[model samples]
Target: MHRLFKNALGLRKCRAFAHDESGALIIFTLYILMAMIMIGGLAVDIMMAEERRARIQFTIDGATLSAADLQQTLEACDIMEGQFRSAGFANVHVNHTRNGAQYESCGVAEPDADIAVDVASVEGIGYRRVEAEASIRVPTLFMHWVGIDYMDLPVSGAAEERITDIEISLVVDVSGSMGNPSTSGETKIFELRKAAKEFFTAVVKNDPDDDSAITSVSIVPYYHTVHVGEDLLDQLNANGGTVSVQNPITNPPGLTSVQSEQQFSSCIEFTPNDFKSTAITPSQKLTRKAHFAYGSSSTRFPNYLQFECQEDRFDTRYAANSRPHIMVHRTEKSQLDAHIDTLTASGNTAIDVGMKWGVALLDPAIQPAVKTLADDTTIPVPSRVNDRPANYWVPSVSANPQDETLKVIVLMTDGVNTTQYGQTTENQYPYINFKNSPAPVWRFKNWSTHEGKRHDRWSVNRNMEWYDQYLIYVPGNSWSNRWYRPGDPNTSWDDQWYSTSEIPWDGIAQMDWVDLLDDFHVDYMAEFFWDEAERYYHSYYGWSTREDPMEDKLKASMITQTNWWQANTNLSEICAAARAKGILIYAIGFEVNTGEGPMRDCATEGDAYYFDVSGREISTAFAAIANHINQLRLVQ
Candidate 1:
């Protein structure tokens, strides 16, 4: 009975143990926890791998960009390695163009593809697609029991950059206003000088990497007029042959025009619709001639180029002074620096001429000085792979259509639009004192009116001293006034009998060229008729101001004011054209007391285009523009 009972108990116990729920739930829970731990470890590893990938990619991008810089003298490989190591990356194998054109690296990335956009260009301009692959083994904390010792993470990254070629035309205002004090208490011109020098230094960096491209700079200095070089002046039709400009008179055969027998310095003159355009498109639409009817730089100018009578100047000033012209065509670092120092301030502010020349210089159609210095090492142009305008600005990379060249014109001014002097006539001669109190005594208002008349018809109203006194041969009247000043308008002139004592009565008949030449009469005309009629004796000869009428003629008679306000249209059009053609225009206005409205309109689009005010800000503006331009010179 006891054996039977013990067997039943043990069978029941075995059945209970087989169906037990408590311990089974505990075992199942333990197994699930172990699996969850393994999965969590994998998730941690993946998260770490993703973080590593981002970090490594950032490092690679930095390395690639730095290595592609034109100013970067360090090797690309070394740069990449250094960057990766700094980013806490170990055992990284980097490779690509070394000691060569590109800044590419990576042991397993495509080496030849997108090596660099233009690494040899200034400041890493183009896209240098850099790729980097990282292999990292993460030690697992919980997966070791499953025979997996570590997690293999492969992190790869790639990146690209682009920089274009830059061409800059720096136009500054050398007008009188630039000499004024600025906000920083310095001369605006001086600030401009400092700014310009800084700009040159910042842009024209002699980088070995920028071998394929260059940053070209040209300067255009201006005042009331921008004087072009002789090359452009020689190209004019007036300079060619048989030059004739319209005159005021119609008599004396060919007396109705001024002829250019002598070459003169080129001046900004008429264009389409009697306005100056920045587009100096060397076409024959409008004649490109300088205002050379008057050549004397002094206040007195011979009103006519060559006519019946020309005045002899007394104490001229500009006989030896070279006609002023701009100093920059091609910009070398040293030469640019020198030019910045030599800029002086003295002249009316003519922004129109300045802007015209500034934009005109950049136009490929016209660049004589630039062409001359394109081959010089001091001022290099763009890339010279093709024969087009040798060493001129062009795209660094030919294959990439997106790669374009950049051209810039920095136009700066300190004053408002003042009137420009214009000479619309030729025979504006006033050989006799224009408005002297004794003028018009002879009644010869126009020289051409007496072209074919007789001497008796012309009359002199006075007589005077004989030493420095003037004598006139009125056609058949003869050189000696021995006919007696009969019926004089002022009776005192007739009573001046002592004046006849020194008169050359006998020498009059001996005069051979006495066909009554008006030219000879004008050269020795007795001016100041009122005063001379009262004078009797004076031993030493003296020059009377009335004898030379050149000063009066040039003062207001020859120089006429033009509506320079019309120049705004030309200025805006030029800026628009340049901007349309991918050219950048920066217009800076310093102490623009009149208004910066025109200057603001002249600048290109965006804040980068316009800078109004002076002092350190001028330099700041220049530096900003330069940085932008320099960036263009870089190939990524």
Candidate 2:
């Protein structure tokens, strides 16, 4: 019985051990399942964080880019805020400061969630950067049974915007050719004017108000020369006038003899006292001839009559209007308008002169603005004589204090240099004369003293008949005279008497003279470009307000003017200088045939600033240039 009881106790202990082992196994299995759930939840949180990071990155990047293009700092901030919200980052908080670097953000989506982002170096870099962070509360799945409710998942990203500033210059052709009708039946000049005005308005409208903004524009108008009107005229007197008139044949008035008589009579009635009673001679009679023979094809009688009348009336009218009457040419509004109206195309082109004058006006060395009292007081003045002991010099009243702005020149020409006139030379003449020597004669008297002894008498006489002899005389000749006469010592009738005479006459002939040719003075060329640049710059900045006698702030670039039409070999140097000085040089080749020598030398490289436009396309080319300049400005 004792042995059996011991065996039973052993069996019971074994069963109890087995039961404890099973319970331990169950506990192990539960732990393993809980661990698996936790692992899965962590994986999901990681994925969510990564996806959020990507979304935030995309949103920040887009917003930063948009902000970078903004003209104002406030606008940039607004853009960032709006963009983040739109991207579903409603919980994101943004802080902007002018401390010149980095956009900072910090926020949480829930009590258990942590979210943070850093957009570093927002100002130190050329681009603007935005840092973003997103966080969410991730509830545990099976792990919830272990008393852990949720975990915080955070994602972060950064975005940046790239920015660049550009400078541009526009050169336009305003030559007479631009007035030609376009395919649209409007003058190229008209189209160009419209387009240019639009472009100017648009660019000015969109330009950034920030002082450190990136873009600026300049307009240059050139024909055979450019006309910058009053500003340049006031600064350098560089504005040139161009006069164009329709061909007589094309603009003839349709008037018959009766109509012509009527018109003439009416004109006579309105004529001033000085012009009244001018003789109407038959010389003014109109002959009936084929219009074609006169270089015309119009068959209308009125047209023919008008054509004839125009030819007769043009001279008188032109003479009266073109008389050099004005003295100290003024450049006021009325004057400029009148000058423009008076511009008649009748003189040789002088592109160099025009360009020169234009550049002079914009030369900072010549015309700078005067400083105001405020600026003068704020900025320290440099000592003029440092060698001397320091003393109060009444602050040498601020010379021109205008800002040193960019310079530009636009050069254009219709034709190359031609012959110049108004010069003088010397004149000379030659002549000749001859003289004759006297002859002697003897006579005997036979009579009277026959009674006394042989009487003898002697008489002498001479004739001067060689004075009219012909002799060819050459003034500059050294060789010989065609008609040379040798004088004789012995001659008729003289009683041992020597006869001699002086010849005072000499042949005279005119000498040939040579006059030096006048050099092709292209004064208009330089003046045109300089004036255009100055005028445009001034217009862009508004005119100067000081009364200081400084150089014109709107002068053309002298360096550019001197080299504008130089050889191609020097083009790179010329363009380089212009670019360095922040000057945009625009060149137009009008009716050019010299392989673009001048145009290429004058224009910027890559054809970005040069145009070789035909006469009819000049306006179009100018419009295109203005449009390009407009594009450089910020767009709202």
Top model by TM-score, which number?
1
Worst 10 residues of 2 by lDDT: 512-521
Displacement of the residue 549 alpha carbon in candidate 1, Å: 16
**TM-score of structure candidate 2:** 0.35
Which candidate should be chosen as best, given lDDT against the real structure? 1
The list of candidate 2 runs beyond 4 A from truth reads 1-62, 68-75, 84-93, 99-172, 204-222, 225-361, 368-576, 586-601, 610-636
TM-score of each: 0.57, 0.35
